[model samples]
Target: MEDSDDFLRLILDSIAENIAVIDEGGGIRFVNHSWSQFGSDNACSITQDWSKMNYLSVCDSAALAGDEFGMLAGNGIKSVIDQKEAYFNLEYPCHSNNEQRWFIMRVSPFELNKERFFVISHQDVTERKLAEKAVEKLARRDGLTNIYNRRAFDEILSEQWQQCLTLKQPISLAVIDLDHFKLLNDTYGHQIGDDCLIAVSALLKNFARRTGDVCARYGGEEFAVIWSYTTLLEALVLSKALLEEIRQLKIPNERSPIAPYMTASIGLVEMTPNRILETRDLIAQADDLLYQAKESGRNKVSSLIVVPSSAVENQN
Candidate 1:
């Protein structure tokens, strides 16, 4: 029996995953060698004597401090111990100061000497998670300019609209159209036109540095910008500056009647969200204003603020 116990311990200690066994009351009864190594690597103070501690108590303390993963882990372990669940698993991030890391925690029940115990194991899965993130980013990006594609733009606009509505903050939208783009493409080849688009997209990136700001390729020669928690006056000021900067790029467009260099028209709109309004309504208003700007002059900005009828009546 002594030799059998030592053989079992040797096998458990050789496995790479961190493994621990806890009794019915959640008291840590055994831990493999990898468990001690993991604790030391993470700078855990209690690694020296894990058998003297209650695993559930540690999870409960972390839960009280508002660690969401701790709460989830504690509940999952309890479900297994109570026989309500045959197995349980959870994937969570456990990033260290020097590197990002992810792990999958699993719990399973076992019978030992007429008593029930749970075996917990944690396995590293950071590589898989990072690959998934890279794939998602590629799906959301435009092929030509490398900015966000139209599909991503629509999704992001809807998300930002809801967030701004919930926070009772203002949201702004800007629709931009390059002036006489077809003429430029006709004069210089499609290659130069593509280069111009890339340059403009790069410039747009600078304006979207704030959190919740998004710049996307709406379509050929068209782009859209969403600004969360911004007012009409603020968006208008930025729109005017964007026009000036595009002109400064001095991408020659001798064929354009409006100017010797390339320019753009912008339609800007701002609104404090309400239940009666939808995201499409905001896009429609901006599109109409953009058309008006093109009709009046090719290189200018037209802006409007949308307010609820009740608010307008109160002001009157």
Candidate 2:
């Protein structure tokens, strides 16, 4: 029995996991090389008691709960250990070199002579996680302006629409068109016009960073943003901010009639859950407002706020 036990221990310890044997009294009796390595470099030995380690609480909780506690030990880790089942592919973010790093953890429980034991393994998966995230971002991002792509916009819109339907929240949509973008291209060359587009995109992006905001390039010289759960007044504020931000760019629009430099026309439309508003209708209304801004004079913002009346009222 002793030979068999020693052989088994040798084999299990050889595997890449922090393996430790706990006696019936719940004290750590043995810790393999892998287990010792999990401790801080300043620590002298693994049998020095688990409570002395900085991460003891994290490890203990994960051992008790099947839930996914984070690397710092929360409900997640506890879920796995409490169930006495195997856990795999658990991911959590860590800070290394002042940057985010990801780790994949696996934990399993074992027993010997009625004593409880556990094996834990953690692998650095930062590179793989970053690659996967980058791919997802590229798939959902517009190449030109680095805004969310139309595909992402569609997904967000559909999700928000469903949410608004259920929660009866308000959703606002805006369509913005660059004023005389073709004229700018003709006067400054297409390359310079592209630069202007990039600059304008940056300004719009800054505003869209707010909660429940999403922005996308709807195609050439045109961009769109959807604000979920936003009031009409809030939507109007963003619209005004967007127009002013573009004007501040000072792209030297010597050819523009509305201003000495480049400018944009923005149209905003808000829909409430009480109203039956389709995404297409919301877009069309905002587009109509954009045209209104152009008609009145470019470089201005016009909002079409939906109300109890059948007719639309204009807000600047």
Candidate 3:
């Protein structure tokens, strides 16, 4: 029996993935050779003497400490241990400060010596995760400007609208159009027009670097941006500074009447969504503002504030 136990331990260690056995009480009963080594390699603090650790407590504690990944893992494992589920599997990011890494955690229950125990395994899945992320990014980004495509922009904005509405947070939206884009394209040809769009996209990307800010290529010669949790007063200040920065870029547009260099007209809208309002309301208002800007002067800003009916006059 002793020799057989030694052979079983050897066989378990021979497998590459990190493996551990937890008793019904949720205490670590055994760990294969790769377990501690993998923990050490990944900078996990729990590597030393893992057998003495209470695995479930560690996970629960981490979850309580605000680790989202740990919370998912704790719930999944608890479900299996309680016999509510036969198996559990989770893929999660475990990236350190230096290198990106992903791993899959698999937990299963088994009978050992007339008692139930769990076998947990951790397998590196960084390559597959990274590949999926790359594909997702390509599908979301525009081919021409390298910013978000119209489809992604629509989906993202709709989601943000719902989120802000639920949270009762302020949201700002802006639509920007290159002044005299058609004439500029006709004069300089499509190549130069594309170049101008790319340059403008870069500047918009730079301007929307705030947390929860999104910038996207809305359509040909048109762009849009959104700032979550921002009021009209704040957005107006940012827009003024942004337009000044863009004007300073000095990208030549000979056919543009707004300036000898490229210039843009902006339409801005700010709202704190309520049950009575719809996401399209913001878009329509911003589009109106953009039209008014162009009508008043080619390179100016027009804005509208959307608030509750009672507060409408105050906003105006």
Off by over 4 Å in 2: 1-123, 157-168, 254-260, 274-281, 295-297, 307-311
Candidate 3: which stretches are off by over 4 Å?
1-3, 42-48, 158-169, 240-261, 310-316
Selected candidate, larger TM-score, 1 vs 3? 1
In angstroms, give how far residue 199 of model 1 lies from its true place. 0.5
- Residues 229-265 of candidate 2: C-alpha lDDT, one tens digit per residue: 8977888888888888888888877877777788888
Q: Quote each prediction's TM-score.
A: 0.93, 0.65, 0.84
Q: Cα RMSD (Å) per model?
A: 3.1, 6.1, 3.4
lDDT of 1 by residue, 1-316 (tens): 6569899999999999999999989999999999999999888998789989999998999999999999999999999998899999999999999988999999999996899999999988899988998999999999999999999999999999999999999999999999999988999999999999999999899888899899999999999999999998888888888989999999989999999889999988888888999999999988988998999877999888889863210000
Q: List the residue pairs that clash in candidate 3.
A: none
| lDDT, model 1 | 0.91
Model 3 residue 148 lDDT?
Answer: 92
lDDT of model 1, residue 147: 97
lDDT of 3 by residue, 218-276 (tens): 89988999988889888887777767777887877776777888788888899888888
